[model samples]
Target: MNENSHTMSERPHLRVVHGNPTDEEVAALVAVITTLNTRDTPAPPPPRSAWSDRRTLHRPPLPHGPNAWHTSTFPH
Candidate 1:
């Protein structure tokens, strides 16, 4: 394997396709672009907690007949 091949493959993540720009200018441009991209994209919704699960709220009503207290301790 060529020793310089690894260095060659480590190209800049962002490259200007057109127009010459100074190092600081390129950095500023990248920062602005990244900020705008992040701003435009909405963040993913937060994960739902078990306490807020809708399915858990739709449980069968607890029985009121004999052994109601015992049954309530376990799933129907």
Candidate 2:
């Protein structure tokens, strides 16, 4: 054998063997994934018919200004 061949064999080698995952391991992984997928609860809906009476009680004459005749292009 050559001197170079001896040096090549001195390097370390690793061998890894993996087996099938267990059912409990799969269940735990699924639980973690499910937990991550879950989101916070949405805010509750606003009260229905709120300020309905106040809207009807409003009675005021709108002031007609010089710019009032010009239609407002701004969106609501």
Candidate 3:
């Protein structure tokens, strides 16, 4: 008959295997995330009497080329 029917008749259908993880897998993942979040410990605070200096943060300037000024690159 049709080519699609002929191909289907020649090939064997395969069954897909799918299943959910056990409770142990879920608990192990949760324990890993919890350990990661609490791994870093904060240091003690500096002396209250000592005076700290404040400084301004600056970023480097970008290149001024033709492509840098393109209109399509940015949202309208």
Q: What TM-score do all the candidates reach, one by one? A: 0.45, 0.32, 0.30
Q: Weakest 10 consecutive residues, lDDT, candidate 2?
A: 8-17
Which of the two, 1 or 2, has more TM-score? 1
Candidate 2 error regions (>4 Å)? 1-19, 40-76
Candidate 3 whole-model C-alpha lDDT, 0 to 1? 0.59
Worst 10 residues of 1 by lDDT: 1-10
Clashing pairs in 1: none
Per-residue lDDT tens digits for candidate 3, residues 1-76, read: 7655536458634322566766787678678878887887676787664243232243434546677767435643
lDDT over C-alpha atoms for residue 66 of model 3:
70
TM-score of 2: 0.32
Cα lDDT of model 2 by residue, 1-76, tens digit: 6654535558434222476777887678678867776755566887868567586686554546687545444322
Clashes of each: 0, 0, 0
Candidate 3 off by > 4 Å: 1-19, 41-76
Model 3 C-alpha RMSD vs. true structure (Å) is 17.5
RMSD of each: 5.5, 13.2, 17.5
Score residue 75 of candidate 3 by CA lDDT: 45
Q: Native-vs-model 2 lDDT?
A: 0.60
| TM-score quality measure for candidate 1 | 0.45
